[model samples]
Target chain A: MRNRMNQRQECRLTVGTLTDAMRAQSLLSASAIRSEIVGADGVRERREGCGYALTFSCLQEGQVRRILREAGLRRF
Target chain B: MIYLDHAATSFPKPREVLSEMTRCMRFYGGNPGRGSHSLSLAAAEKVYACRRAVAELVGSRHPERLAFTLNATSAINTVVKGLLRTGDHVLISDMEHNAVLRPVARLAREGRITYTVFPTMLLEEGRSPARITARLARLVRPNTRMLICAHASNVCSASLPLEVLGEFCRKRGILFVVDAAQSLGHLPIDVEEMKIDALCAPGHKGLLGPQGSGFFLLGEGVEAETLIEGGSGYHSLEEEMPAEMPERYEAGTLPTPAIAGLLAGIGEVRRMGIDAIHAHECRLIAHLARRLSYLPEVTLYAPQYQGSVLSFGIAGRSAEEVGLALNRMGFCVRAGFHCSALGHRTLGTDATGTVRVSVGYCTTEAQIDALADAAQRLCRRT
Candidate 1:
């Protein structure tokens, strides 16, 4: 079937596209609510939006003890 | 497995049904009229094709005249809520399920709609046709706006004399609505031929489809406004709902996969032919009823008008007891009111209820024999 407009223009909205848009909106909301960032050597971590992230991979054994004490908690 | 509950919902759906539904879910799974993509267009086409197919099956002139619903109950609700208001009267048969009966009762209690229930007349053996017609004509009232009846009784499988009732409604200008949940794919129905203004059917039942799919055929001149509102995909710019036939009634997202399965089910029915299926069920009912009559303990409810169901009660045994015993024997049976309290009362079996053994197209002679044997064993135990 030939239309006055191009093939893509002729059909702007279809079933698949609408469902994709609805699903995308849902994913975007989740992305905005919580976030996590990772740095090299498994050494650094950051938490965004709601809570704090504790980094401990490359720190000395004694340094971890001091950080836990300052946060008012002990690691078993 | 022996499937005798096809009257409730057909089991062992045609292989094509499952395959086609899977195809829709995999390749064309998209919200209809809600997007702009190739897959979405395919999904919309599938839904539209089903609508057109269903409309043609029920003698609807236009596909848009019919509206898809969750089940027959939902369709009935749309009609009851949208069209009826305070002071209007709705008439229904005594054989109605709680789906229709309870809603009407609530309406009556709140003083929204004055409702009347007409009795279902039974025929005597060797009775003439004229006697049955006269019995139905007496129920029509001047204030009755709608006359709702089941096409066939779920409790007894008695085929109603809708042709005669249709004539009565035509003369009185009453809107004749049929609750076709029990009859729709098991029996041939043409709304125009039967003078039915609206027909409600469950897709999961006789239509041999998934549970969430059902549609109502709206006859000409039945002006039912939408019971719900919001997105209809076509007229998104309009703040108000669409004024078109189906779009007016349909709001929000439709169950695409279920409707796709329903369309496939209808296609299977078309191929096998509904008349052939009906004939097969009638034969099964006849055989079952005849065998049941031989047992002294069996109390056949509707011996004269056995259609697709054979409802009976074992003397001295409660319906639930018999149902449990039958279940242990690998036979499934439904007992109690079957959600038709009025039907039970009208049949004079409300106190004890009755064991209903309904058959469908897939029911075989072996299953019927098993049912008869199970009843005999139960009868002996009682």
Candidate 2:
């Protein structure tokens, strides 16, 4: 019983550590996206807060268009 | 031809309101209360200034006593959920919006608090304030801790005589909460003179602000528990919520751009003057109600001297049918119960509901004329 409890606590700690790392990485990448030029920055950056996941690389134009579309931006 | 649903959400917000919101989005864009840098400080200041403006408008001495919520509904919930415990009794009015009724009803069903509702209509139109005061004086029980009411009805725009109600609550040593979502910026409110313990209002309705901006003002010495406990950026060591007024009530990141828009909106309202706006809207509403009453098929609800809102029914058509017909003619008005089901039932308009036409500061006399013409045409058609 003691061993099982210890394993659960270790698993929780591991998950928490991973979450913090992901948050830090996203924050850094979003800043890079804002600062970097629109095109030719192969790593396409995206700005998202809290519960967002980066499924595509920062440099993908298709992914950028998809993100903008999903955000309800329209062509005038 | 007209948009007469200001009671739901005011349209065509002041141009400066949009510009200020855009400016916040373009620059000084930072999470308020999250950092001590210049950008964060500017964002925080923008929010604080709005709190101060709201406090001054409502006659609150301290701006920090106000807390921001998504809307008055959530603000009322935050207070109702935070304050009441098991076996507590409350007093309410017959004209309350569901924002107050639903939460209180649920709590009553849960056995947390039971309540009594008083009818303000007994006072009559142009009735002396003392009549309403006498009615309320008879309703207060020993166990009653709070008396919450809508200062103005969204359905009919009939304003409750707050001076009498406020004094009644004061003399009984009970707390009084006023829902001012419909009349805060459009009508002059003096919380100090009114003896209002708490007021919940939405920024989008009469304040000409963007969506998701609203606040609650609590009187001194009336502290409700914090429902959401998290980082308020004030204390890093403490695990529990802070015991401060707004800081304790405000948890997590606030909508900074919304607050910026709210500050700009309040400035425009202050420049125009709430009394002037109230007079303008009342004139338009009274004109529209008078014209509608002249139509043989029209059945107007509430007195002709109500505020900016007017509710009516066509003898031959459903409220929804008439509303849609008006909409087809380029008019926008709200139909149905307006979220006051119990009140509608009490008034015997539950089945068909009432068509509501509410005006705002930007609403012109010509628009009211057009609305009256549309109603005439619809009546002719039916």
Candidate 3:
């Protein structure tokens, strides 16, 4: 279950739940977009009471965000 | 051990089931849907994959609508308690397990609703879908909000015609719920084709998964009150679980290792096709039934139905005695009511509580022959 993830990636999408992260991850995977879900410990990951983010190495930020939004993912 | 108690829970699970569970505990033992680390997400993905696999196997298009629960009993409680309301009436089959009966009975005891026992053609000479539907039609009332029944009896081979009952419920605007405890992996189920409002099944039995894994799959247009409320990994900002399908019902962290085992179990079942598994078990039951029928002391119930389970008793020895004797002789069989009072009463085994022998996909002809010979010896002693 080992995966290569860029922890310092610039493109990161923060989601509400683990299920949402999984959904967004699956959608992005199907679209040939590689992303990794990590603990949302970043300042941007802070919410009222949540902490799970999906990180991406994509240069095209718009497309990744678009896929996340299209999949109805609740993001920060 | 010659385990024949599959109706209780499958034993000697496939190597894949055992290996996957060990892998999950070792590699990704995080709480599913509870965390966001690599191990957590990996576990979450495995759980989702299992849901998708189950949905596909049961012909449910909405994998998200399938929620994992402790077992079929908890799922049935969620549905029966969540959906039923005051002034609502329910109809249950005579062969329903306690899972279906208890919740419905509790609701009725609280006087929130009422229920009627609809007879099934367990012993009728010429049973067919038409006859079964006609009998159900006779019991249907305008206030009948739901029809909860088992896909197959837990103690015997009698199974209801789900397609016919589903159509009847749809026509009457009644929710059709099925308890597939004894039939999930052993019989064909199409939630979409059957028009089932809710389908409950245990992963341990026919699916060959370990204990502690089961699922509740909801059909379109079916909504039930949240039976339990807690931290749904998502929507913690709000007090209510989100209106989403799974997150709505799954209030707490899911069982990851058991789900991982279930994923492997489903893989094994798929490797041996559903039809092939069912036919193999039924063939074994048929052979055993044929052999036992020759003994004048033996009486087989629900012999005509083609399924993985069969029930019988010896005239001289009580079911408890026979079950113990079989155990001593290295043949494992379940005796007594099997938690299905309604089923035993309907099948006329309430007094004797027939000894139940449930086969599985891996059960062989040699095992059936051995069990048959043991049964014959028991009969001869009588």
Candidate 4:
């Protein structure tokens, strides 16, 4: 479990608003991509306006971006 | 205590429902689709799961088509006020509860729409489906835009022939709306099989969920005007509400705790199987009907087994008096018109509405026997 956790990386994706961020999270979940809202100090410093960020595993980063893009979501 | 008022709202909800609701309030306290934080994500997951559960219960392929509402009244209002336009005619059965009747009546009184109420006698048992279909066929006019009916009457438990009506509507391109308030969890409803355009159901009744929880299931190509518009947490920049399935209908902060409870309630229903619950309730209804029919002074309004509800009155005593006596004997039953004056008018009980005893999953055979015995005793006093 430690090795698997180490392999996972956090990726921050900026959304238009908090709602959009949540919608993105739901879409990603439907595609079996596990993600959570970004809460680290570095991520908080990066959040702009009402936009928010999320983190996911590095292995699923590509698939997550692809799904978010298909859902008309943009990354900061 | 024998609580036979399931028709109003189910009591003693499944243990899982209460626990799940408490968990939601304590742990997942976030507005669904309002934020991207972990708590919000968890809350969103619970809401989506609830949507899926409601969709599955009503046999809808697209869970997104289901929209959460405050109750069945809101659901029916969303469909009625949103769909019916000026000069659009509607056909409804005379057995509808006030939830459906009042709104439609208000619209008719406003001259926005004209409605006709068909007699429930056509759908009575032993009546030929062909004859009933023919009668409904003649009632349809060129401007008949929709046919709305309650799946089962709250007053007498008389059920409408949905399959026949659905087929009739499909052939005529009329929208078929069903108020499944009393029948959702008690019977099997297949939207596809019945060609239902929309279904309005409450979670607290047969679904065994908390009050203030219900949903409106919209079939494909069915669209209704937004009843209340505000923040849907989507398309924030746009001044207009998003033209989407659920978001278009759900326009405010949803009751997350109630929805969580509804998810657990649906889970319990699925686990027990709708057929098993129906069988159990039907057995109780049959037993109660048989025993009540034997009393000379007890006038059973619905002597035959219709569904889970049984309405009766004593020959000389008013329904309220009997209901009070039953309450003194530790029986909780619904008295009066049951908010369904039209149904009482149909049953010729508009002057003296019958007492209603509605059974649920928790109701047992012993309770039914006790209720019958109490009714017999009340009759002897009269």
**Candidate that would win on DockQ:** 3
Kindly state the fnat score of candidate 1.
0.03
Instruction: Give per-residue CA lDDT, model 3, range B147-221, as digits (tens).
Output: 999998888887888998999999999999999998899889999889899999999999999999998998877
lDDT per residue (tens digit) for residues A1-72 in model 4: 001233335555544444445566778888888876643234333333233456678778678767877766
Q: Write model 4 residue lDDT over B177-274, tens digit each, in one string.
A: 99999998999999989999999999998899999899899998999999999997655666988776687888899999999999999998899988
Tens-place lDDT per residue, model 2, B10-45, is: 888999999999999899888765654557656766
lDDT of 3 by residue, A1-76 (tens): 1122355645666665556666677778999988777776655454532467667774756787777666555443
- Give residue B369's lDDT in candidate 2 (0 to 100): 91
Per-prediction DockQ comes to 0.02, 0.02, 0.33, 0.15
Chain B TM-score (each prediction, in order): 0.95, 0.97, 0.98, 0.97
Best by lDDT: 3
- List the candidates' TM-scores in order: 0.81, 0.82, 0.92, 0.87
Q: Report the poorest 10 consecutive residues by lDDT, candidate 3 chain B.
A: B233-242
Root-mean-square deviation (CA) per prediction:
17.1, 13.9, 3.6, 4.9
Given candidate 2, what's the lDDT at residue B131? 71
Error of 2 at B176 (Å): 0.6
**Which scores better on lDDT, 1 or 2?**
2
Which CAPRI category fits model 1?
A: incorrect
**Runs with alpha carbons beyond 4 Å of true place in candidate 4:** A1-76, B122-126
Of 2 and 3, the candidate ranking higher by DockQ: 3
TM-score, chain A only, candidate 1, equals: 0.22
TM-score of candidate 2 versus the correct structure, residues matched by position: 0.82
